[model samples]
Target: MNDSEKISILSKLISFKSVNGHEKAIAEYLQELLNKYGIESEIVPVSDDRADLVAEIGSGTPVLAVSGHMDVVDVELANWKTDPFTMTEIDGKLYGRGSTDMKSGLAALVIALIELKQSNTPINGTIRLLATAGEEVGQAGAELLQKKGYMENVDTLLIGEPSGYRAVYANKGELDITIKSKGKAAHSSMPALGNNAVQHLINVLNKIQASIKGYMDIKNDVLGGTVFNIDVINGGTQPNAIPGSAEAVLNIRTIPEFDNKKIIDLIQSEIDQYNNSTNGNISMEIGMEIIAIIGNVNSKIIDLIKTIAQPYMSKIKYTPEQIKVAEKQSELTGMPFSTTEIKTMGVSGGTDASKFLIDQPNNANYVVFGPGENNAHQDNEYVTKEMYFDFIEIYKKIFVEFFK
Candidate 1:
């Protein structure tokens, strides 16, 4: 397929506002797109409006899967220079909501699958396109797909996360904890008639803070051990009344060292101590937990990525142990691709791989390698035309070279 044709698919994908709860429509579109190319897909319902898509070509184990979320984050309309859903080309950048975040990467992967099938080359292993839903808000889709045995026998998986031409092998995990404090409500004028949930929550927060204070002192080798933030809080209704219940949502970035389970255990200990010491009615529940593990440095997936990517390197700084595979390039001659916008962009809290690789073999390899910038949740997200086109070629080559 040509550049314009590929971009057209991306444009169509962006047109669907497949936000956290609205993934079913986009899933259907992708299924139809694959069907047009004689590739049939199954859309597994994730919710009333969300679904996960699985399409396969070729056969057998040692499967190679191109996976990504079909959903994008919500857009802040006022901040965009242009429409966030409409594909707009200013200079060389294709501006849209999911353009850089992942839709472009998904588009490229889908196109690669299409072209690979068209090529009729003997693929020794199965090539699957596993598109997930609700990756932005929750991991229900990934967990469901995993339970359905979709990740079984997959030897190599490529995630369509925003990493430009470079391959990002490791990332921190995300664990969301919601601490709830319940108490009796009474009028503020009454001195000791009521127990304040807000006050109880304050005590809980203090204990939580003290318990995990030194977590980052001894960090993991890749992406640190833990970095946490309180993202949401809900409590109290009126100033004149003592609150009956309060809850705080804490989002933690975790590594293999200070993982989700350990963190949960520590917090649960604190909750237990508080409950026993002050007869506090505080309780903790996990909102969501995404697992984290350092990618296998010497895996065959990374090795082949390094192999095909070596010739594309103009000025390189990657090795076997390193994660960032290669720098961006222009054709074979090469030119500096501007990464000033991406340098300021934040990383994903976690990818679908965090859940998809749940019970898979330890030798199963995966890489976050795809086109576009890292401006995932930022306004006016975009991907350059060159990066999009180049990755389509790169993915096509990777698919062919893998079984050879």
Candidate 2:
């Protein structure tokens, strides 16, 4: 496909507000395009009118699943230079809300399938194109697809996330914890007679923060260490009348080496200790929720990807130390810049790949690859037009070379 056609497809996709679970329009659009190419597809619908589109070009075991999310993060039009939904070109940059963060990846996969068809490449395995919905909202589409047994026979799964042409084999798992504290309420004038839940919550938060520091000591070669943040907190009623209830939300990214349950128990213990230390008649409850994505590289897949990428090794930009050490290395490296290699490490961010892994477990060998700025879910999101086209060529080659 030409750059113009690619740009057009991306523009049309961005025009639709397929935000999280609202992917109906885009799913329909993709269905029509895939139909035109004579590819058969099926829709795995999630609640709220959102659905994931799966198009299979071939059949049999060792299926290759090329996937991308059909959702974009919420956008504020006023904050954008142009309409966030309208695809605009200035210099060499394509401006749109999901342009880089991954509508472009969908375009690449679509174009790759179109090209593969035109090439009449013979494959021994199935080539599945999965356009998942709700990746921005907890990866619900992938989660559902897995539950429905979509990945049952798949051998390799490639997730089109914006990783700038790098292969991401490992990412950190997430745990979201909510801590609530309750206290008796009374008139502000009689402070001695009343208890403050907000104050109790502050003490609990301090203890949690310290506990996070201790958790960081647990590390792994691939995953590094866990990272923690107090992303949300809600508590109290009005400013007056001693607040009766307070709560804080903690977001923790865990490495592969750490047992997720152990971390949860540690956080709970810290809160319990804080409650016991306080003489006030305050009660506390801690709720821990985990949203983990598996982070391990399949050695066979890593070797295959490296072999495919060897011809373009000169094009890869590596740090000085990495270049010297990896120059003669046959195994795929785990550093951040080695996008073509399957990673055995984990990171702090979660993706649809996590959902797929959770559902399938041992069903498929999966990795994430794409083009765009790493600043996903951030303001002023943008992806380079060059990167968009480059990924198309790379993906096309990988499919043809590996499957044929």
Candidate 3:
């Protein structure tokens, strides 16, 4: 397939507006696209408006699943240079909501699969295309697929998350914890009679931060270190009234060694110490655990990616437009990528890769790769046209090499 055909497919995908929790339309569209090429796909319903599309092109035990999420994060239309849902090409870059974050990668994989089927390449193993939903939110579709045993026999997994040309071998696991502080509400006029829940919440948060910076700290060679951010803190009814209840939501990115239980124990210990020391009507409660996942650094997928990417590292040259864009980005980040074509790196955030690799030891070779900047939740998101096409070529080569 030529680059124009691939770009056309990408444009069609971006027009779907398959924002998280609303991917059924895109799933159905993909099914139709595959049907045109005589490939059958199954739409696994995740919700009323969310579903996953699974299509296979070969048969056997060692399955290579090309996975990408169909859903994109919500777009702030006013902030974008162009229509966020309409995939527009300007100055050799395709601009859209999912263009860089993933739709471009998904398009590349789909086009490669189409071309592979047309070529009638003989394969010893299956190449599964898994277009899932809810990745932007919490990887709900991938987790549901696992629960339904869809990935029981898959040998290797590839997530086309936007990482430019880099192969991401490891991503820190995430745990979202909500801490609630309780207190007795009284009249605001009498400061001595009322117990402020917001104050208690602040105290607990301060203690938690201290613990994270000290005893609760852990680090990994690949994933770096565990970190937490208090993103949300809600409390109090009115400014004049004493708040009775308050809550703070924290997102903790942890290494593989730091499990949920250990972190929970540390927080509990801190709470215990605080309660013992303070004789106030302050108490804290833990909320539901939203995300808990782990990733691997030395999987077979990493080696395979290295083999495929090494040849293109110093060989491929960038166009002037590509160089200009890369240079501007490099200047902004203080990291030059002018001479780097492909490299192995690590991500601090999480991805669906963790869901696929966490429990399945035998089939846990996972890698995140794609052809766009790390601009998922940012404005003016775009994918370089040349690199986008390059990803298609690389994936095609990977399919031919691995499946053969």
Model number with the top lDDT:
1
Segments of candidate 2 deviating more than 4 angstroms:
236-241, 275-346, 359-364
- Cα deviation of 61, candidate 2, in Å: 2.5
The sequence of per-residue lDDT tens digits that candidate 3 reaches over residues 1-404 is 66677888899988987877788888888899899988899999998889998999988868988899988888887888899988888998889988988898898889889888888877788999988898876788887887887788887788888876677766766777777777778878985787788897899889889877784446655656777789998999886789888888888877656755678888878778877777444444444333333335576666666677666656767689878887897665433363654555556667786666557522246778877775777999998887788788788888788754
Give lDDT per model, in order: 0.79, 0.73, 0.77
Ranking by lDDT: 1, 3, 2
TM-score of each: 0.87, 0.85, 0.87
Q: Of 1 and 2, which scores higher on TM-score?
A: 1
Pairs with backbone N, CA or C atoms under 3 Å apart (clashes), candidate 1? none
The per-candidate count of clashes, in order, stands at 0, 4, 0
Superposition error at 109 for model 2 (Å): 1.1
Backbone clash tally (model 2): 4
Model 3's alpha-carbon lDDT is 0.77
- Cα RMSD, each candidate: 6.0, 4.9, 3.6
